[model samples]
Target: MSHISTINPATETTLETYTLMSMQAATDKVEACHDAFLKWRLKTHDERANYLKRIADGLRDRAEDIALLMTKETGKLLQDGKMEVELCAQILEYTAKNGPSILADEERAHSAGSKKGWVTYSPIGVIYSIQPWNFPLYQPIRVLASNLMAGNGVILKHASICTGSGLLLQEICNDAGLPENLFQVLVIDHDISDKIIEHERVRAVTMTGSDTAGRHIGHVAAKALKKTVLELGSNDAFLVLEDADIELAVKTCVEGRLFNNGETCVSAKRFVITDKVYDAFKEAFVKQMQAIKMGSPENEETQLGPLSSKDQFETVSEQVSKSVEAGAKLLCGGNPTDQTGYYYPATVLENCLPGTPAYDDEIFGPVASLIRAKDDEDAMRIANDSRYGLGGGIFSQDEDKAFRLARDHFDTGMVRINSFGAADPNMPFGGVKDSGYGREHGGFGMKEFVNAKAIYLP
Candidate 1:
């Protein structure tokens, strides 16, 4: 057994130690999960839902403690972390309430008065879920709730920075009476992630991480002929039309870019504003970005927290530096804090060129890049130019035009009109292009862990 050390991203101090699972041990655990799936998946949907409900209850009861641990581990605001925990519970409850119906048999009529045909949703055996640290609780919950309620076992390989959150999730499942090995956390090194993916027991894999990691995992899963879902990177564009409510657009842009200190995969990374509203939007946006508090995530008054790790901080910093060198003006913030941890101030860049590093790169920190456009057509062109097509937002007072732009032009899998992009329990969430290939959260999320089998009567 290898020992895993947990560190606080805020202080760069050791927080806890855990026994990391070896490759052989991980294989054993996966085998156990496969065995448990045999029994667990055989249970009635209602029975499985009861287990999910118990997990939700546990999460709700310990929301505060879980939130604090999330903040300490991932360097997100305590309030945001608390919201993440609550959202996790909500996801579990939503899955428990809706999974049965979504997975129920669908009946279809025969063509010439023949027998009726039906399609059934069945469990897909063991799943390997690779989650990131940004939304530590919510990201894993999005996979775990849907899979468990759909009668599949999950083996989570969460980011090293958020191991505490992963362990807590395991504890919650065990405490909620989930059978042994039904849901396990593998505290293994990143180098061995591919080895764990190659386990024969894993039928499918899901990941929410960088594009590079997604490509590597997708390759491994493809070689094994297993199904894979990748929620990769995003350079989501936030477009502001000339007719948009300037205040609303600015507010949404600021909130979207700075939320989670701009560590979110779907956060608005690029701003494409029409020439008419460009100057006004920038002025208001810069002010809001500057007003946001930057301090410890635990403080109630704090709105921004440290980046999750030193590597992430440095990468984002380097990207900003290159963007400036490439001719973008630093409107507000462009420097990291001198204090401990990976803290960086909320930053905004203007006049960023299309091909610059900041323009195309996904900066996973509190930084926003602005791009000017001549009109809606130019805005659409700018938005669709990137390789990423995750979540995007379009702001305009003309509902018809906004709707048309969202339906016809936005390259992302999800688009929000006049509001910041978000995922709800009822709606589907995923992305197109290099952003990834799988859907998580909502009805689609449940189906990702299940196999749809067609049954026909002869």
Candidate 2:
């Protein structure tokens, strides 16, 4: 049997290793989870909500340990990991408190007469969730919490680097009184994962990762006629308008770009600043980027941590190098010191052009792309000029104008007007174009893998 090793990026050491399960064993897990779903679906929404509440409590009780593990495995800051745990717990509680009302039957009128009709949401079977290591626990929980509330079983195939986090999450759910096999983790490789998508017992699939990987999973599932929900990568833009408060925009943009060590899909990456404030924003932004402390994720004072792995570090470094070669100017913090571990300091690139990685693709690290816009109109135009549309931000002192732009003109799935975005339970998540489709959070996720049946009554 082959083995998977979980690495600590901060130390470049192996924390633990596990043997990958054989195909037969993995198939058995899918079957078992589907069996659990059969019985689970018969329970009322309130019963499911009670179980969800228990799971939320369990997450809180174990937040410290879980957050520490995340820091070791993924190199995200310990504080961010803790906040992620809280966000995950909140997602569970939100689903529990609001799911019954969201999924309750709705009355309608029959087409032929004034007779009453109703629609019911019935749970499907198993959901195969493929998640990335960046948000580890939070990534899978978003899918798991809602699907369990909708009465569906969930099988997880987390990123190979975060296998430990995946197992821990599954254990937490079962320990919190969720029935056996209702949620399972598959510790196999991609080969088996593809076959599992075609598994008869697996009814749907959901994934959060880069668009390249998301495309492959989505294709395999589509071939088997399975539904897919993918939350892919983005080169999200943050606009600094002419009327923007310079310091506010600078502070918020720095926080947005560097959060999660700059590995977030929706974090500000492209800085589209109007020419009027371009010089001021660049000067302040460069100073802030340079001042950020890059060191151990365990240090509370360390403002930036290493990339998730050596491979991630190499990728970000290479992208920056290529962008510089393509005529982008390195404003500050582009050099790598002799630091141990996979550390890459905060870097900024300006005059980022159309064809370079900085302007075109998601860098997935602490590198910012600065683009000078002619004016506010040009800033909005440039923000929309990407293949990705997951999320974007607008900074303007004119609150009404920013809101209007976000509401009517920002071509992304979600937007922030004069602020930054972290996924919220009360709002919908996911994106458009190459960022992939399908919505989570709010009440939409609970219904994604369910059958909405319309019934006509006498």
Candidate 3:
């Protein structure tokens, strides 16, 4: 076993070291998981449910320690990390409560004199889940819990920055009495990810990462004839109509953009406001942006944490500078502080034009670009102009108009009317267009890792 060192992205500090599974080791683990699945899948639904429940209990029991570890590893606020731990437990419990039923066989009547038809859900062998660092625990657990409960062994390739969280998950599973290798975490270098994905024992791949990475993984999986589910990056739009509640819209916008220090893939990247309320919305939005507290994530009072890494901080900072050079006006917080960590204040940019870099790009930091819309038509046009159609929101007082805009105009997988785009355990979450394909939560998420087989008997 090779040793892997964990480094804190914030302070470039060494946190801990653990033995990592090599490519050969990961391949062996996948084969072991495949062999284990023969008996694991044969187990009764009640048994599977018990295992999931135990995993949830373990997560809940160690929530504090896990949360702190996640904070140190990913630089998220401790409170947010704690909430993520709780959410991960809830997801596992939800899967335990719902997975068996969702996978229950369905019977259907066939044509006259034909064989009866039926559909059943079955595990798709070993599934490779490539997760991001943003939601270290929640993202991986969301897939792991459901896949494991469905009797599919999972192979996780978590971001290098969050390896500690990944190991913690494996520990939780072990404590829950899950078989070794059933939910293996591969610690191989990033270069070897594609080789593991191509392994014969791996039947499918699920990834949540950059669009470029998604496309690359998607291509390899497609060539191998393997099923894939991808949750790519997004440049989501938050449209506020003329009749929208200005105060409410502004508050939600702030919360949406600044949430996770604006590191979320679903965070609203573009703000399209109607002329009627543009001034008011911009004023309130900028004021709230300025008021956000940015410091050490360990501090309970810190509203915004450092960017996950120096690369991210520099990326967003450069985008802000280039946007200003292209005539976009910086209302607040465009400069990076001289602080120790990668801390840039919540930024607001206005008068953004089409040719600017920030106009079409996804700014993955506490930077909000304001685009003025002449009316609802312009708002829709601006929202749909992007290549990305992930999660988007429309703020409008008129119910009919909001519904119409969301249903007819918005080009996204998940749309929110009168609310910023959010996800829940019960809702299906994914996106359209360049945002990549496939859903990741609720019943839809469970199906991503399984194979739906139809049976007919004559």
lDDT, model 3: 0.86
Model 2 Cα lDDT, one tens digit per residue, 1-458: 49989999989999999999999999999999988999999999999999999999999999999999999999999999999999999999999999999999898889676799999999989999999999998999999989988999999999989988999998888899899999999999899999999999999999999999999999999999999999999999999999999999999999999999999999999999999999999999999999999899999999999999988999999999999999999988879887779999899999999999999999999999999999999999999999999999999999999999999899999998878877999999999999999999999899899999999998
RMSD of model 1 against the true structure: 1.4
All candidates: TM-score: 0.97, 0.99, 0.96
Off by over 4 Å in 3: 1-4, 18-20
Model 1 stretches astray by more than 4 angstroms: 1-3, 110-113
**Taking the candidates one at a time, how many backbone clashes does each contain?**
0, 0, 0
- Candidate 2: regions farther than 4 A off: none
Candidate 3, residue 353: the lDDT equals 81
Relative to the unseen true structure, what is the C-alpha lDDT of residue 191 in candidate 2, on a scale of 0 to 100? 92
Weakest 10 consecutive residues of candidate 3 by summed lDDT: 1-10
Q: List, residue by residue over 390-450, the lDDT tens digit for candidate 3.
A: 8889998898989988888799988887777456888888999889998877877877776
Q: Could you tell me the lDDT of residue 301 within candidate 1?
A: 96
List the candidates ranked by lDDT, beginning with the highest: 2, 1, 3
Candidate 2, run of 10 with poorest lDDT = 105-114
lDDT of each: 0.88, 0.94, 0.86
TM-score-best of 1 and 2: 2
